[model samples]
Target: MYRTPALLAPLALALAASAFAAGEHDHAHEHQPLHGGVVVEVKDVDYELVARPAAVQLHLRDHGKPADVSQASARLTLLTGTDKQEAVLRPAGGKLEAAGSFRLAPGTKAVVVVTRPGKPAATARFTLK
Candidate 1:
């Protein structure tokens, strides 16, 4: 009857809206860590941050391929409770690394900013668990 169509119209519209929103999201991007680090995606690139008590390492991948970071540098800001610390990471081997004693623990948050000449900086936030 006419009432049946009217009642299904709202459901159809809701389903269509959800499908549209999902199609626009990048959930298909691979989020698995390549170096046992927390991975975050920014601007179609994936950044992995590995935190340890003795050193920190960052890895970058674009479209599932290793990104060239030879001319890149990174700064990291780590926040844990009321204590905060910072470190500068430079290109080492093929990744950016900083060597120092760090105060890392569960629930810590880290913000990383990577900069390269003639390119905009890429930033990502990670929470350790």
Candidate 2:
């Protein structure tokens, strides 16, 4: 029932440090994309998918920084009602882009799979609005 200050100080510091680490991990998936798009976390990486009338772009970020996905390839599948379409995305600048007219309405469902030469594939699913 008797504890010294030296013993309590280290215990308090350890608890505070653990709480801070938990907070950081909880906020890792709550990132807002620089470009207006939907962000999904795949294998601890953030992938922001932007659907436009003329193109579909996928942006990669690792720990809140831009990730080089130039050597990566991606496949996008879009489903609207009973219709489905798929496209191959090629690297363009800082993102992977596929140039085609896509029908991304409020209820469209999308699934994207990205693969690199020596890395396992990662998938992200989204519903458009």
Candidate 3:
């Protein structure tokens, strides 16, 4: 039986649109910082960095829920103009914490390298304005 193009066009379009939406939904998520930090997503995981004047915090989440980072460690390197600083982050409670005064200023940049058990290392970059 022959079908009219007008009848088939919408059906085909709907199928295509739905497939695209489903694929996108499964691959990426909207990023919102839960801890007043800059949020970055890497392979469906979210990393939030809250760089304070005297402390540094790194929060992790997967799919909007707090991620288990008990076995994870991160190294944060801060860059502000010609001055540079680095800190080792140990898992403290839900976030990785480090104690020290970071000379954070406007236009500062941070590069974090996170290592989790049995997973490849992930790196995220953030900038403070």
Candidate 4:
């Protein structure tokens, strides 16, 4: 009985250590964006924003799979130096898009707020070039 308890102690400690280490593993390894865009995590969902001069695009992903945004709406705020602009985004082909002239130079800051029916709004912030 004494030997069995002693053997189980080390096994329990090893299992605990492994569980701790697994929890400590970096989350970045799982959030890489397929599109060349800046990504932010909010409420276990990944929002990838692609800014351009002609339009701004936002992609949604959940657990590395494309998420449906057909019933969602978004608002984008862009800040560059002292100039600021806001646009309302609508769902377009599995992504959210706003068509407008935007100043998306390097160091520009963007804040995106997305809303869906019966769900709380989700927000993400990004700096883009």
Candidate 5:
């Protein structure tokens, strides 16, 4: 009886350890953001502002698939000289584009938030002058 109990003790400990590991792994996956259907290429993103035209243009290229940008929507909040401006983005020519009517001066910061129809939302940071 002593030998049997000792053998079972190790098996019980192993089972407990395995259960704890699996639970931790499951929790990690649960908290991860699921990037919807769009695969964003962060390195290819560019932002340009035309102060005279009072417009800001966002350029994004998706080499993955044509449908990636089609269903994506974007919103931008620009911080310019202590003032904030918001712009709505629309799908245009394989990219999600946003144009602001307010003239963006140099040293402006912009935060772009994009949401895809079925995928996880993503954000991009840019500067405008």
Candidate 6:
């Protein structure tokens, strides 16, 4: 009986070491983002709102775990040349997309604000080039 405990101690230590090594291996291939917390992907479909040729299409994707977006709200501000327009986004096709009246061009700067239910609001800035 005493020998069994002695054997178990070594086994536990070996298992722990293996787990640590595996974690280190995973870290090598992991790509860490600049900021922490969940990430939302925003894609402008047909809009450039900056360069002045294509219409803007904003695609907001939840890169984190799936959560309810019923209460979520989003606002996008697009700066195109000398004009600026604000778009209020609504949830559509599991993403929030807002269409602007004017065609936004590439290399334009945009501000997006997303508010999820029961979570603090998040804001992101992107340049569509």
* Candidate whose lDDT is highest: 1
lDDT of 3 by residue, 1-129 (tens): 777988999999999999888867564457888889899888788999999989999999888889888999999999999999999999999999889989998789999999999989999999986
The best candidate in terms of TM-score = 1
Candidate 6 residue lDDT tens string, 5-120: 88899999999999888855322222222222223243211111222332333333334333355667677787878888887766655546555465456656677777777767
TM-score of 1: 0.84
Model 1 residue 94 distance off true place after TM-score fit, in angstroms: 1.0
Candidate 1, backbone clash total: 0
| Candidates ranked by TM-score | 1, 3, 4, 2, 5, 6
Backbone clashes, candidate 6: 16
Off by over 4 Å in 2: 1-30
lDDT of candidate 1 over 60-116, digit per residue (tens): 988778888899999999999988999999999889999999999999999999997
Listed in order, each prediction's TM-score against the native is 0.84, 0.76, 0.78, 0.77, 0.52, 0.51
Question: How many clashing residue pairs are found in candidate 3?
Answer: 0
lDDT (10s digit) by residue, model 2, range 18-60: 9899857654445777789888887778888899878999998
Please give the distance, in angstroms, between residue 17's alpha carbon in candidate 1 and its true position after superposition. 4.5
Give stretches of model 1 more than 4 Å off: 1-29
- Check candidate 4 and list the clashing pairs: none
| Candidate 1 vs 2: which has more TM-score | 1
The alpha-carbon deviation from the true structure for residue 69 of candidate 1, after best TM-score superposition, in angstroms, is 0.9
lDDT of 4 by residue, 1-129 (tens): 358988999999999999999867355536776778899888778999988899889999876678889999999999999999999999999999999899878999999999988879998999885
> Which lDDT value does model 6 have at 93?
53
User: What is residue 99's positional error in candidate 5, in angstroms?
Assistant: 4.0
Score each candidate by Cα lDDT. Answer: 0.91, 0.87, 0.90, 0.89, 0.57, 0.54
Q: Is candidate 1 or candidate 6 better by lDDT?
A: 1
